[model samples]
Target: MSTQMIFDYVIVGAGSAGCVLANRLSAEEQNRVCLLEAGPKDRSPLISIPVGIGELLPGTRYNLHHHTTPQKHLNDRKLFWPRGRTLGGSSSINAMVYIRGNSDDYDAWEAEGNPGWGWKGLLPYFLMSEGNERGTDAHHSGYGPLSVSDLKWKTRSGHAFLRAAESLGHRPNNDFNGSQQNGVGFYQVTQRRGRRCSAATAYLHPVSSRSNLHVRTNSQVARIILRGEKATGVELLDGTKILANKEVILSAGAIQSPQLLMLSGIGDQDQLRKSGVTSQAHLPGVGKNLQDHLDIIQVVEASEAVSFSEALWPKLLTAMRLPELIFLNKGPLTSNVAEAGGFASSSLAGGNPDIQFHMTAVPTFQHGFNKRTCYGYSLHACALRPKSRGEITLDSTDPRKLPRIEPNYLSEPEDLQVMVEAFEMAQDILAQEELSRYKKKSLRPEQKLSDRESIIHYIRQHAESIYHPIGTCRMGSDELAVVDSELKVHGVDGLRVVDASIMPTLISGNTNAPVIAIAEKAAELIMQRSSRSFVKENRHTQEVE
Candidate 1:
């Protein structure tokens, strides 16, 4: 093993949160920050292109490609959970939808005993992180690190999807993140000049020249090294120890943050003993309270060849647009497949929209891995808040081994009812007159939707995660909470978790934008704490002298 190196701050997982933390913490020259990423740099051309998600989502090159243990509620099938492992993390592989979720979602967090996490407290951070192309407004800003923009190009089917939703009295909303979030509209994306603006692209790359900021890729953290109840540093898989004089932050997202904590012997004492690991903090919530958005897709064959598909003609057409994408930064290739969608309340929901939609201008089979021969479009609907909760447990003590994930989807009967309502709503939108021009026939659910039992069965068989996993390392003052409102791990010092994993509950929409906003707020909290500590240390030194 090499000699131990020390730094003021060490951030594991150079993902969305890690990149933001690195940039903000290292802004002060006195603070030495080291960022470690398990994956390679985010330099692939495919990662820059919006359409490259088709290739990136299904492959293991830039993805962790984690799978859940067989779900009992869903016919004992294992669901694929692909998370980004590269420098940018999931932002490099996500669909780039810029959604902050419902404002009430944040308010609910505050209601649950978490102060300063409500919509009002978090809005400033969101504004500080966004550089929207549409300019500044009450809820947006034009001067931030991340660039949010309208799509340079969109599929004709996407427009039709919006019109269809409006035709059904869903309302036509141009901005989902504006004064209202309940309407059909085009989703602004995390893009800059038609290119994917991942967190690394927005925050990390800009400040990479800072002398105090050290970034190391392809370095996997084995476990956090603790002394008593305090985190002193981290041990990498290669047997190298990097001490953190100030703090060690985990930005490894929902799946891995708790796994790391457990692997480091900070979870339930009994569970750790079962894995043959010594117990440290004995926080049983380290890997419990797992929550995710389960999505069901409805595919319809298009009467016209307007959808982007793997069919011969569409493939050739996409290729022909490459020149336009390269030169003008505008073309079909610039389209984030899930171009337009809306938020609506299910019949069972109260006040806020309980169901969200994502309209894709292509037929996706098995999470876009299988190439479809037909030209079609798809509509995805998911319940915003699922009552069913799950957990993540260790398979062994080895850090290299992935934890056993059990989302336990559809275990709650209320969740199933909401999904059933969402499915019918999707069917209603597709049947509208606005979409009749493009719709040929319903291709999925292969069973008659007239019967409720059939709809329920289809949902169980087809429902998949929309890639939003959260709450494994939840934030709250409750006993099950792994972190507090300031994001510090419970019962442990010199350690914090800043990622989607800290969300007490999953928000009502896409998680990427909210995760960025969380990091922005976390940066402020960390800086304030550091400043106070410095003052206290200086005062003590002067008194002693």
Candidate 2:
């Protein structure tokens, strides 16, 4: 009375990591791979446009617009967290800046017991995943699937912000992904010509014709079907069961990956029982160690008419610029909102930058939901590594329900201290004479925020998330680690979580580039194991013959 289809590999969530897995795993016709996505096909015109991040952030059609529960810190304010729910995941809906964090960040991961994850261990994967427009070098490769290019159209305000940063003693480095990350400059984007090159665009779309790989869109996974402690397959929201002959990979990201584990009765025993899920495995770290970069924006009204806000008001300019974008791939529409940004170190970090600055040529407020009708610029400062940790727990037994996200931002006193220091440091750069030519007035907080306490007070009221959430299912060897060094779920066979969730600690920059590299490594690991099995089987056959 029941029907089911089996796959060599069943990948949950056709997101940034899932798409990569689908592409690599199904390269061999012998291996049948299935990818399931909860969202619809990524056909939105806004998704392809680099500047359309403004249009996509507040909308829910292609975005899982999530909000964290009210934080106990920061006057108990609930922060907005929008993740891309469509094919490419957050990569499709993000600012598209391709930043592969600092080398030390990865080195710290190796120091934390995750071997083959340090920068030295994973540089080949990063190079293999990138198709840098700048061509091949010691640090980059030009012949990969993902395209990385410089901005075709740079704004005057964005350039001025860089000059201002330089005047404040920060050296200008063209490539943030190069030898050192502590510098100021325009960011290279995950774009080709001028359009967004998300993970789906780079890996999945090109391989759509492959018969061996099956991509199912708009199919939400309820939970992984476990046989004892082994993951056999996944059950869909519509009650259809799909079996995995080889393995089941959970690439549902920092939030959902852990939620799925908990739903499948693989999390803390007490928590699973409360959620009406029978406990099968007791992994206490299923949804713990939640981390994210908390960002605060400082807006300055421009003296001249050089902001993206102008094009929005005239309306006709936007219409006229469409052809330029469509044909020439050159216009305001080509701008990846956070056009120019770089890394810097405050007193918080010993040497490397612990804070990052995003200088956008538009006055953005409330995560691009409410744009002020004025020509202005914004300086976004985010603490690179906040000591604060949070958790994701089940809200109910229903898999359709969203999980409870509690980032507990600024819970640690040092986090608040770094935020205040970063805020003050940003003010110093904004006050430089290089930016004096375009500076008009400070829009958000008054220009008189000189003292430390007042700046902290302002950050508490106005700060919001930069949407870089990670570490919910951390990969390490500790007792609290959900995944081991190989990214396999502890105590569960044939199960693994490969996404931003598996990060032991949050990276120092935008998470997209690093996540793609993570998937590349995962693909290698899976293929190596499969190859060894084939060799062993052949030996047995020859011996028996």
Candidate 3:
């Protein structure tokens, strides 16, 4: 708690990867680890309940709740970008959908010269980190920290969506993490016994009593203290300096990790100078190559009152069912809104599906903020991979000030074309007989837009982020690569980044699972370095004698 305090490893950001790193690094009884979080502890009642995502997402204490600069291509709309600011990071506030993305996503990383990062290379770590309720197999493990299970509460609309998807000729696959990721089915959530199982609950909370691990909440890290080229420690916003004797790992998610790097003067020299920060390392790629998934929605009014809209559930009925949810863990309270979905290949897809669908049992108005008064359900389709790129630049020298986020959505002409095709694909599935029985009327894109131009127009007006942002501090062998294959900063020692920001490219699905896996591997790397250091110290002692 003091400025003179020192730690063997000081991890900034108590987020998804940060929680994993804190647990693994402190496992060694002799090693002292310090985990700092800018927000408070994960004690909110909403954070524990699965359906509470709707409340936590808008502007709760758990969310960073950032907004992007107006996009030139998206009719100059400033999209709301919410990142978790709590103990579990986005894992605490996310929809709880568990997806590892495509296997080829990792394989492509290996192709880009990042060895031991391919699907095969990382599968073992994935297996080690997961605790699937379905038991162990080649693709999953039953004894791990994070719990992955089927939804305890199901809606009729979700089942209809899957049936409708099957009618469109897509195969019905139960496991999205299986050998193939091209099918329609329900999503597995990160929950245990109908409650949300965030990274804090999975990893950190279970081990908080360990004497070697120290977790400081509501302590914001201002900047990394670089002694020449090496990151020796970090300074808090209050001017307290805590030294890191061995290493400092940044797990502040995609946005803040790069922003912290830039604040610490590890980014482009020109950019650092302009922001009034003295240059420490001239890495031009600190905030470059930013990527995120963009999605569009199609809402349909339900003919029956089966949907989970606010109007469908009376206040007294919901209050009466509290006993069932508390005792049995089987009720509507356990629902993770986006229940069922699938992956499909668009016209632009090569070997794998390029578009993904997320079908919610409730009607969503502006990311679930403005709830519709009628019963309805919605389906979302997003481009898995986009050609358009963006960047994060400095807004000011103040560490507390948010960075300027420019996703540059639809900057690439081909991206808009793919969106048009995805829109049409989503429309086809909603019109199938399985779902048509419940459909009363189409609520969005009011009239069916058949022409490509009209489809594009509809997209620009309604499209928004699916909340997966990555690639700012990319890892590669290219000139702009910020980190190497080992996740170590290319130009600095005693420092590494272990979050989504280090991704060379965005993965094909939800990012939480992959981020946890990445930290599992990083923990091993850090322990390996500790082993070698201990051996060298012993050898030096023998030479002196």
Candidate 4:
């Protein structure tokens, strides 16, 4: 808390990756670490409940809630993007779907310039942060703080889904993450005893009592203060600066990572001049290549006696079930809504799967936010691998101004072509004999699914992001690349970014787990280098002695 004292590392943004880096880097007896968060504490009960994540948004406490400059692809409508500002970051407020994505997703990263990020190199960190509900091994870890548990009483729809897949000639796999990831099954969730498990609970809670570590909340970071080419420390909103003893690592995430970089005069030279910020680096790719998963859900009418609509009637009676859920930890209350999902290849040429299925127990609005209602099962399909690219630009030199995010959703014609396959796949799923008993004739039958023109029209009207935005500060060997594989800024020293923003390409599943894994691996890399430096200093001292 004192400016006079120097910390080994000054970590900006106490989000998912920041918390993990703080815990791992400050574990020793003498090392000092400072973790700063722009938002308040995570004391609200709404953030802890899986279903309660809905309320976490629309308020200042949990959601930072920044809006993008109107998307040209989406009819000039500015998109509302919500990132958690609390201790755990988006991990606290997101729908707790825990996925490592497919192993091929990481292999594809190696195919790009980043070699050490492949599945073989990254799985150890992934396992290190996981306390699997099943157990421990090469695939999962049991000693970690984050709890990955089974959902409450596999829903009736989940059971129906499994049977439906088998009837459709699709094989059912017990564990999708075990031997492979290409099958229909229930999703693994981020939960502990039926309660949501945020990264703060996983990595920050235990270490908060440590004297060497100082966790500062509501500390807004404006820019990375630099002396020559090195990131000396960070400047606060009050114009006060905290200089670091060793390094300044940014975990501000995808949107804010590039925003802070551009604000600090470390972006495309021309763009920086236009935004009235002095250029610290001429890296053109600092905010380029932005990618996100765009999903469009198809709602249907269900046959009687099967829909959750009839089962959830009598709202007052359903509320009584809360006690049973809390006490016995067995009920619908523990459901993450999106219980079942699948991954498939969109290309008939037999490339790796590029499309994903998200079967929700409820309805989805234009954006992710929606009112609670008893309705038929919902299915969402998003292209896992998109050919389109976008950018994150600074609106102005002001630190308070939100960044301009142009995701360029469906920019490439291929992006829309992939969505068409996704729709056809969803229909194929419903056509299965197992689901026939539950299928009521199309509620949106007249809603248009016939011609290509009709499907594209529906897509333009309905598609929205799946909340996994990444690659704004992409790491690679390309000239446009902002950082190298080591996570260091291309033209600066003593500064590194360890968050989803540095991903070379988007992973195939939920971004939370991969984001946490990035932090875990980055922490080890940083500490190991520090330890080697200490050893070298000791050896030199021995020679002088």
Q: What would you estimate as the lDDT of candidate 4?
A: 0.78
The digit string of per-residue lDDT tens for model 1 on 1-545 reads: 47688999999998899999998899889999999999999989889999988889998879998899998888888999999999999999999999999899999999999999999988877877888989878878776779999999988898888888988899988888998889999999999999999999999998999999999999999999999989999999988999999999999999999999999999899999998888999898889999999999999888887778777887888978898988998998888899999999988788889999999989888997887888889999999999999999999788889999999999999999999999999988888888868877778955348779888888889899999999999999988999999999999999999999999888999999999989988987988744334334434543575
| Overall local distance difference test of candidate 2 | 0.88
* Candidate 3 or 1, higher lDDT: 1
The runs of at least 3 residues in candidate 1 whose Cα sits more than 4 Å from the true structure, single-residue gaps closed, are: 529-545
Model 4 clash pairs? none
lDDT of each: 0.90, 0.88, 0.88, 0.78
Tens digits of per-residue lDDT for model 3, 108-219: 9999999989998778777767889998888887777899999988889998888888888889989999888999999999999889999999999999999999999998
Which residue pairs of candidate 1 clash? none
Most lDDT-accurate candidate:
1
* lDDT by residue for model 4 (4-83), tens: 44687999988889999988888875888999999898888677767665457556677888776666666676667889
Residue 458 in model 2: lDDT: 94
2 or 4, which is superior by lDDT?
2
Model 1 local distance difference test score: 0.90
**Tens digit per residue, CA lDDT, model 2, 408-510:** 9998999998899888878888888877678788898757598888898898899999989999899998889999988899999999999999998899999
Clash number for model 4? 0
TM-score of each: 0.96, 0.95, 0.95, 0.91
Candidate 2 ranges with C-alpha deviation above 4 Å: 310-313, 529-545
